[model samples]
Target: MFYFLKQRFSHLAIPEKNAKRIGMFRTLCAIFGGLCVAYLGMTLLLFILPVSPGESLVIPLLFNTLAWALASLWIVLAPTRLRALWRSVLPTLCFAVLIVFFFFKESM
Candidate 1:
């Protein structure tokens, strides 16, 4: 099974180990993590910066989209498999923490 998939995705430019098993999982993590980080970062910026409503809404959204793209690129280009996972996962954890904090704050 591994050998079959290894050769299958070689042409698609996916690494063997990645394509053989965990490629989809890695891709999902990177994509979703990037989105999560973007939202979290946007929220933080909105709270910290004293911008007008326009700037607050537009700038953060732009930055968030850019961050997502950059993060996805980083994951694909990382040299090691674990590095790719961690790069995505670490940001996700950050987002999770921020979300928890926001929820906790709201409950108070």
Candidate 2:
């Protein structure tokens, strides 16, 4: 069955056992990373740059959308998909930690 698939749809086929196993993992990670990039990109921009409230809210929204698109593109184009996943995952984790830390700190 899969052999027929490989023959007919080589581009979509799982090239190897490892890639087959990791495909789902990579896909999920890419999705999560894209979301994280959008959120983190916006937060980082607001945290680091001086964007006043008087300005249109669309600025950050546009950046957030662009960030997600770039992250998704990077994941798809990367030579080593696992490495790409980790690269985004690390930053996502870092942003999550920072967000949590600040949330707690403010409450204290």
- lDDT string for model 1 (1-108, tens) is 999978755544444554345566567767876777778777777655677656788788888888888878777666555566677778778767876786687579
Q: Write one digit per residue (lDDT tens) for candidate 2, span 53-89.
A: 4464567778987888878767655445556666678
Give the best candidate by TM-score.
Answer: 1
Model 2 residue 41 lDDT score: 67
* Cα deviation of 52, candidate 2, in Å: 2.1
Q: Candidate 2 local accuracy as lDDT?
A: 0.66
Candidate 2's displacement at residue 85, Å, is: 2.7
Worst 10 residues of 2 by lDDT: 11-20
Q: Which clashing pairs does model 1 show?
A: none
